[model samples]
Target: MTISTTRKLVGVSAAAGLILALAGCGAAPTSNPTGSSGGPTAAASFKPCIVSDSGGFNDHSFNEAALTGMQEAAKQLNVQFRQVTSKSASDYTPNMQALVAGGCTYIVSVGFNLSAATIASAKANPKIDYAIVDDPADANNDGKTDAPNIKPLLFDTAQAAYLGGYAAAAWSDAHGTDKVGTFGGMQIPPVTIYMDGFVDGVNKFNADKHKKVQTFGWNVATQKGSFTGAFQANDTAKQTAQGILNQGTDVILPVGGPIYLSAAAAIRDSSKGTVMLGVDSDFVLADPSVKDIVLVSIMKRIDVAVHDAVMAGASGKFDPTTYIGTLKNGGVGLSPFHDFASKLPAGLTDELKSLQQQIIDGKIVVQSKATPKAATSN
Candidate 1:
């Protein structure tokens, strides 16, 4: 890949500053700091906070990605920030309330599970700026955010997932199986978007290669398939992955957060020779334990987006503009093949690059009903 194309693929340069700032990030503050370094004088009192979903910040997924951004923001601004981890859905409101009570100037709720609580908090406290990850915050289905204070941090993951799906299908075809599968954490829009893109990618591969590759877990037409119903790495997730693997699938895409761990375990135990795909964050780098079995990750630059949003808020530039991650920008794309690079088919890498450009050029439209609108792609 060329320099510009590599930048678009995984947002390496966009995230470099945040990664550098992470070295100076301290633990959650017991009390707010006195002043900030890289902001206006009024920003001395700016206190940003974050709350994680049930998966906590150690899920090696979106929650962790968001926390990384928050830490980087705090470090660069030279301010202390607070954080809360939710054990279940019920803790969302209470967590947001605690942050509000702590006099947080800007709060970020990580994940779609906290959308309701984020909207409620934003509505109740109009002075505070809020941002939500992986949700549009369209509580009434009116196709807009419910509150002005809340900024929607959404990702067009389907575009990147299509690339992943096509790569998986090609890998399976090269292995002579021509069978792939996918399962999600839940039936929600964020989860299903990946499945939808994967389905289309496999169809594209079949049409292009004139081969019959079967997708086992997800059915795009009926919008029904296997799901663990939760984003936990547990027995249910493992069993769901095993069920997909039992169908003789050569590759499987698990759409949940930490559920990919269970799928990785399933891949390791069985003799199916099945590889897995990751979502949100790169699994191979996030958790090296699954590096051997993972093919590639459909990555959304959540950390970079979160950092930019938090920085803007700290500098008194908070806007409710919806940020959409797409292939055109460095927002969403696939990770490198890593160890699996040598195992791929000869021309597969070049083909994926061409397809990515095609998608960016609007030649290949990866459609999904769950795609976010009014997108300010960055």
Candidate 2:
């Protein structure tokens, strides 16, 4: 008996619709249908495959999430998984093609950087099912890819960031240093989504309370300005954090992926109320010494996503086009505050929870360019 239920978590939400169209019902089958580390027992009928971005498989961010998802599917569906980690952008085409050539029934390209290559690879082979983890090509925003077989996973991170940002801004108001800062890995929409959401959350929090908290690299009215590209540089991130620190910005939100390490380091060493907000994976543990200086984090559920996609292909449910992961569906959310729950507000936490429910229920919309025009704003 196959049982499925869409659990709408109040604080959680990805791409199930698109994948359902690609695999069809006849792809593969296995006795053990839910993966749990037993390894694949059968080859099944359809095989699922994934090609990593230049960050490789263990970047502790998107790539890692994808791997976790695929592995889960492999165990549960008893389907074969072919995974290739790319060392550089040049490896995208070759790695993607290698999976296609290996008779993969479905192929997933891990990031937006692989969009062009996924397109060419899909067009060349008309029968294969293809997918991209972030950003869809075609530049038309027309809900169509260059190839009919490809599917895209686009996340509405603006919602998640809103919660995170709201928490950050409120934290500042109570502990009033009158300033905050932000930076991210890249300027691409995927990266920008985090920045945009962060700005929106901060603005909303301030607006509700009627305060003018000066922001570094952020303006909610026009939605612009941020700093330090790349998630790998410690020095640059440190310098950026230090600048915000000098400006009396006690809270520093750095969406710089793993580079948040630098920001945490600076916050811990500082004497003032200096603190850090993280993105993607939790940086609280990334540097436990800075636990006191750590704030909140915005998260994307990439691990579960990869696992489900691979399982979809194996289960014969792959569909093309874009798969949207939003708050209502349990694909994105805000991480716990860990040790900082002490200085946090009890009443504000309840308000954030209410906002999350309202946003997901169509009763309220957290401002985002990606959101549908019809959704009401909070």
Candidate 3:
């Protein structure tokens, strides 16, 4: 019934190596799971829980992806699960404590904002197993997990964003604007990593094509740029988007949860046909309303990572080793162009494929100061 006893059953199920299929935003199962959902019902004591950041569970982005994974795992395990949403920074500790008080055995913290609370909760309640998405759970700069019970679900999104940036540059070049822009919700590592890769991707495009394509809203060397200050669809996010658009950028990549919605609005209102790139989840599929304007999305398979972590815990194989998602392992990738496939320049798709293989083959190395390195076991 405890995590200690669960470890004896580790890797007993073949489902441990199951491959995750790509999923978009859909009506997930209710937070409460019933046996009728499907699969073998786990022990009643095997409870898996999740806590969302300020964006809530339906932000059509990172939080939503993590929530969807937890829901699917609970359904497959056929056990009841709990989820709490934090409306602000102050809500993290209380939300985590609520789940602990509710007897959650496995906890998934949905974003970097919940890192401190998740670590503290794990240390205080050594019996519970924990996983944190998009954060390494290293409170000190020691390069090791602060809590042995906490697992880190991280993604190297810079690799995928580089590809998206290249595509954005190609789109802009074909449109004759030869300019792209990117903005984030905040200046955190998770958000800036995308900007770093995107700007580098644009630079790569310029080098390959012998053309000059300017990138706005972010400067990789200085590591400074415009941010909306929060991951919300607000006037500030819209205005930030407009500022980038005013720079004559033909394409824009918005790196935040729901803030992309604000960018889409800015693009629509401008009537200049400025395309955009999505971060976290596939915006075109996650939110069909933006399908017309989204050229591509830099995807981080958070759902897959979360599902694997929960399943591992359910089977008592809760290893705290850091799980780093990269292009080689299908952890991060670019979503299908969908509506923009035909609109891109000729041979761009082939060029992207070549570049992807090169990155995988180590022919091209994408560097970002914010890039996450897998934690070494202490």
Candidate 4:
């Protein structure tokens, strides 16, 4: 299948409509509410709860996306929901335990850092249904990646980041620069998966166009890259982005939640016409302040996955099947160019579309060690 054909197959218009509808879903409750206003009362017997990582619900990334899903499920399914925010790594277990103690019927833990705690909780409370975002909840502490009561929401983000990288490279090349760069919040698999695919996409662009585009902040061979010590430290993220910009990078991809805000600030303040690429959630939609600087976004569709999982669990069809977001499944993809659409070089958009199709068709393989294999039925 070609790029145009793929778009037609995916029903881009319909997807956009669904996204807009979801955007209008009731905002996530700041704290646990008894029931949604103007919506049906949730059955007291069924409660869906979420535990956010340190990023919190307003991080405008994966954590926020997961919460958004829960909120939407509350509105659509008439299910009561609640959420807990983790202030630090130590809070994972306590927060989860608190939710369990509160009689949460299904608990969803966001982020991989909570894997061990989530696994332990799932094992200890085998009767309660559980789902984890961005990880396979291995209940037995075994290497094999599966658990009967836990659903893993994983995304092949490399597939989408690859497209973002290619577009960034093309944009850089068009502007008479061969410099692009990426940085992460941490070195975890979920974070590095994006950087790995980005670097590879830049390499692919270099090879296909016979141009020498340079990538910074990440080295696939060395398995090393630049990172902010913490996900929520905007000051550190800004400093890192400024340092990278000083090195002459005009296209920057920050593979963290709100850290991209720092990069956006740096780009805006530098007055260098630099652009940014967002991860997990579309920064353009999540934060209007960064819309001008975000050329495109590597969307992970976490909200959709979360909503589907909640619906499944509510309808009594919950299973251990891992939901792997891939290009073929509309699980991950690049967002519309938005303001940057008209600014791209001639044919650059077409080139990106073609590259996406190539990846989907197996003509181009976007691989990362962090890529999670689909779960097998036991």
Candidate 4 least-lDDT 10 residues: 18-27
TM per candidate comes to 0.89, 0.81, 0.90, 0.88
The deviation in Å at residue 131 for candidate 4 is 0.7
Best-fitting candidate, scored by TM-score? 3
lDDT tens digits, residue span 189-293, model 2:
677677777777777777888987767866655656656665464688777766667777888777645556677667767777677776655545434555667
Task: Check candidate 1 and list the clashing pairs.
Answer: none
Candidate 4 lDDT by residue in tens digits, 170-221: 8899884789998888788899999989989998888999989999999988
* Candidate topping lDDT: 3
TM-score of 4: 0.88
Q: What tens-digit string does per-residue lDDT give for candidate 3 at 1-378? A: 222212122211112221112223222322334555444456668999999999899899999989888877787787779999999999999999999999999999988889999989999999999999989898797999988899998888899899988888888888859989999997889999999999999999999999899999999999999999999999999999999999999899998899998999999999998999888887877899999998888888777678767877887778888887776666677777877777779988778877877887789999899899878554
Quote model 1's TM-score.
Answer: 0.89
Judged by whole-model lDDT over C-alpha atoms, candidate 2 comes out at: 0.65
Model 3 clash pairs are 6-316
lDDT, model 1: 0.81
Clashing pairs in 4: none
Q: What count of clashes does model 4 give?
A: 0
Q: By descending TM-score, how would the candidates be arranged?
A: 3, 1, 4, 2
True-structure Cα RMSD, model 2: 7.1
